[model samples]
Target: MKWAGEPLRPQDAPALVSKGLMLADSAPRGVVYLSVPLDDWPEPADDTAQALLLQRAVDGSPVVTPQTVETLVTALDRASDPALVLGPGADTEQGFQAAIALAERARLPVWVAPSAPRCPFPTRHRCHQGLLPTDAGSLAKILARYDTVVCFGAPVFRYHAPSTEDFFQPGTAVYAVTDDPDEAARAPFGRMFVGDASDALVRVSDAVTASDRPWPAPLTIAEADTSGPHFTAEAILDAVDRGTRDDDTVFSLEWTSAEMFRDRLTITRARSLFYSAAGGLGWGLPAAIGLKLGRPDRPVVCLLGDGSPHYTIAGLWTAARHKVPVTFVVCTNGKYRALEEFAEALDVPKGEYLHIPDLGILDIARGYGLEVHRAETLADLTEYLKKGPDAKGPRLVEILQR
Candidate 1:
């Protein structure tokens, strides 16, 4: 907890709770603790303090100063090649639109930061370069080409595997705008600006002049080979894309084939995609259920790996009990593909533990009161997804991988 306090008497209760709420709503939001004695609950409340608590407003985000905006505008205009990297915080409604405007006006290539939890920029936009590599060496190599790098809402970097290489070139100028002062202070290198990401982007976009530079080439996806009996990741994602409308569908991804999913699916709006930046297991199922509950007008589909469902299998019961219309597509590869990737990166020896065999995922879902289907072919997967969202209750689709 960032802040903690205890109420010694009943009169202190309102002030403690008010302080906790303010701290929780502040930037880099987090939990706050309030300890109340058991005896205090029986005492009469302070009427004035309770009235003030009810009238309190949420704390506002840190503001972006005019000078900070001017500095960023000048930096972007002076640099020959500058780029924008966005993180989950930039996925807010205002930040999403502001990022697009800033990138367009400044003629900068945009990349989603590694381990981003939300879709900060439209994937199909011409300026989008794709997701940055998580490792230091690869991430540095990509940013090395640019003279300036501006990170919005993201840390300097987030890495899954250990690397000995430096994060950036010596001469490359790096600037970061984030509301979290802790993240700003912890950055290895950058000129930091602590403020609301949306406000900063808007101010910078307004002050910067439009550039005549040409846009970057759009990312291309290789054609899926569906001639085989089993389905490829590409083929499965392609079927999902063909089966759902982009505006009405939201994707909750925790699968191993993230890069392939990015290539196949096009997310053009904020909150259309969700992932966990913490890289924790069991986030996909519950997150999808929550997304469906919050956005009843939009259909939610969660894509998971074979082993991911086991992490939060109970989420299926929650969806079933609520009759939430969520479609869970499990790609049964019979192994933890992500762990294999990490092992390869770290040069660890392969072991039997990596293989997940004979997991009755569909049976588990069925036991939780969810409708289940096994897709034997590309056609079967497409037909199932097309109708899955319209169901009154939750459903699961099991697709065997090649």
Candidate 2:
């Protein structure tokens, strides 16, 4: 499906797609781009939403497609490969466990595509690549090689500037499965399977499995790239990965810096995830606050950028006034570095649009009565973060970057 606008919960697109696809028993072959919320569990549905659900589900299935166990049952039967590309989308820790249960039943290696980029669950799923940091070429390879690329809950035509070093393969079959009709209508890459991603995924897997066809060989786990300088982006993520605890919640605002973090970070068993998929700056800090408000017990950290801060500096005051104890780590790059990377990928010089520094966020955080900390290296950054909750805080840490 085609997804635009601020952002939708990672679950909504997939939930919509998976249901739609199962409604089509022939099964669709394409990519799915699931969009998830930056915060935990979906925001509670409003009364208007309740009315919408009731109106749609007068008898269910034709519309309300019961968020059922049966959908997954079908996926186990249909899967052509012994692995599942489980991504973000779908509410309910209960629903997640259900999907995992089915993955185990089929002995499928499950990897998360990370509806949001700040996830290392790729490694957890035993996937060698972190969100498959390949360019259009590499993605096309994955897309073409699969006899049936059943993407549950994602959009078509993913556009990334430095997405991968590889090139796009044309004419490869692509499919998008999403719950939202607008998402389905917008999909450009492949035919869409509209409905709940979780359910459609389950149904397709079950259908493929029941077919008893020879499943594709499991994708080989990529060996560690121990090449020179170890300059790969994942290396940076690896450097900071050890600092996170399983229980800690992660909120990142810098999308470019995300490669290092997502490629390297380790997700614990009980973890919460958030990020601005809309690529909007400044949402990071507010998102951290939102995540905290949604799950106040966990340590929530917002990894930020200079360009993005201006969009939401007021978030500091709100966090302070509300007494939400979120940790803010500003990766002190000068400006919109992610945009710069995009320009380079397009073979253009840095845009005139970039090249502006901001009033140091540190002073502003302190002005708002937050505990401000500064770190120039990983060691220092880790130490400041370890200081734990401050009675007078929402702590802010500025980590000087090259």
lDDT of each: 0.85, 0.54
Measured with C-alpha atoms, the lDDT of residue 92 in candidate 2 is 31
Please give the range of 10 consecutive residues that has the lowest summed lDDT in model 2. Answer: 57-66
lDDT of 1 by residue, 52-98 (tens): 77987774679768888888889999989899999987888888999
Across 1-65, the per-residue lDDT of candidate 2 in tens digits comes to 33222235533543454444444432222233444456725666456644564456322332224
Give the Cα-based TM-score of candidate 2 against the true structure.
0.68
- In model 1, which regions exceed 4 Å deviation? 1-17, 30-48, 259-261
lDDT, residue 201, model 2 = 48
- State candidate 1's TM-score: 0.92
Per-residue lDDT, model 2, residue 308, is 73
RMSD of each: 2.4, 9.9
